[model samples]
Target: MHLQFITAACLLASASAHSTFQQLWINGVDAGSSCARKPASNSPVTSISSPDLACNAGAAASAGVCQVKPGDDVTVEMHQQPGDRACRNEAIGGNHYGPVLVYMAAVSDAKSAVGSNADWFKVAHMGLVSNNPDYFGSRVLNDNCGHFTFKVPAGLAPGNYLIRAEVIALHVASGSGGAQFYPACFQVNVGGTGTVKPPTVKIPGVYKASDPGILINIYQDLTTYVLPGPTAYGQASPVPATTAWPTTATWNTALQPSTVPTVVPAAGATGIGKA
Candidate 1:
């Protein structure tokens, strides 16, 4: 009886740390689940090569496509569960430390883009920012109430695109397959006149099981961390973070809306919110 109780407690504790990107903030406006292709559950995709590694397992297709222009300050929001955006609790509880990466893929249709084969390009990545008493990007995300913002490339061509937001939790990454990946997708139509197409790579093929970033020991005294995936849109290389990443909360929790933004379907669009 005692062993069973301990195992149950352990399982509950482990489950508390799992999270998913469920909301989006465009130019500081709460877009909510408008164009979000939220996963079926707030769970981790363990297999690196699994097709689920792209958007997430069992994520339904989204019919709503958020309209946005280039150079918008887009923020991806995460929490332990859907529609639970309390600032009192950590967005992702437990010490599920790792990196926060965002990738973008251009497609013919944002609403129907299958993430498995689409060409994805890294736009923003935040890995280990400090080592002396190590601080990770996941920690920064928690500090900001689960909001990580990045800008849409000003030179990106106007078209349909999928924004893939991911958080890798390395708490149990001492072994080969112990890492946890939580990725979510958002569909958007970029409506600018710019016409620059960045380099791209497929999702499942971007992350290798043997890659040092995917398979690493964060507990050890580490000086550098190699970020996974291809080079960012305009960067020369994936530079390893060396400076001390800030831990203070940037997103105003006091002003956070208790409810998600109401998504009004566009003209001729039948339905909206979580297909």
Candidate 2:
């Protein structure tokens, strides 16, 4: 009985391992093709289609095509060469520009998996003035099945710019969410025009009313007062002869006159004199 139980356990473990390995194979096949294979150079340029095989050696896959189970994470990395300059539009007065590339990676299991949906990808060139008549552009699939290249036209103005890649997943199974690659940005430098010097600013030495140094002069001028009358009037009324201003007792007593009467009355009552 114990031997039978052990055999059953081993069988279950083997089944689980087989299931897991199968899922891994699916994910690996999809991502491997997407990253390893390149589209045909002579393939006609067309709008992105469902189950996009443009990058998968012309496979019949459409957009939102997934090989693994539901609910898995997909990773993508897009790259661009610094100076490819292969795409040019001389007829339209546009300058040649380099290509941008994108790649994909995925994680999957028997119950969960993810893959790329290249059909839903789009690119936009930003930082250039809109409404310009001269702009050349074209799209090319990169060597990797997961990446695509966008070329800029010739005669583009020299400036900083970003090439944004927009991707959307369409056929995610229930309970599984789709992933989108972040927009890619690239800096572009156009031919240089003649160098021009920047203008210099010069401030005169004139004293400004708002200057802090002028405040001191204004305060001193306000504190200096000139009397309109003679010295007697110019001086304040001797501080009102107040004892509060005098610290010495003698000075305080001298400021006040003697309070005693100058004359003495008769000792006894008299008609003309009073006691």
TM-score winner among the candidates? 1
How many collisions per candidate? Answer: 0, 15
Report the lDDT tens digits of candidate 2 across residue range 26-89: 2112122221122222121112222222232232221222222221222222222211112221
lDDT tens digits, residue span 1-275, model 1: 97576456545645777899988877776778989998999989999889999999888877678877788778898998889888777888777888899999999998888999899999898887787657888888889888898889987899999999999887766678878899999998888799989889988888877778878877678887877887677766444456666676878877776788648334333222110
Candidate 1 regions exceeding 4 Å error are 1-13, 236-244, 264-275
Q: After superposition, how far is residue 30 of candidate 1 from its true place, in Å?
A: 0.9
Clashing pairs in 1: none
lDDT of 2 at 107: 19
Q: Which regions of candidate 2 are displaced past 4 Å?
A: 1-145, 173-181, 192-275
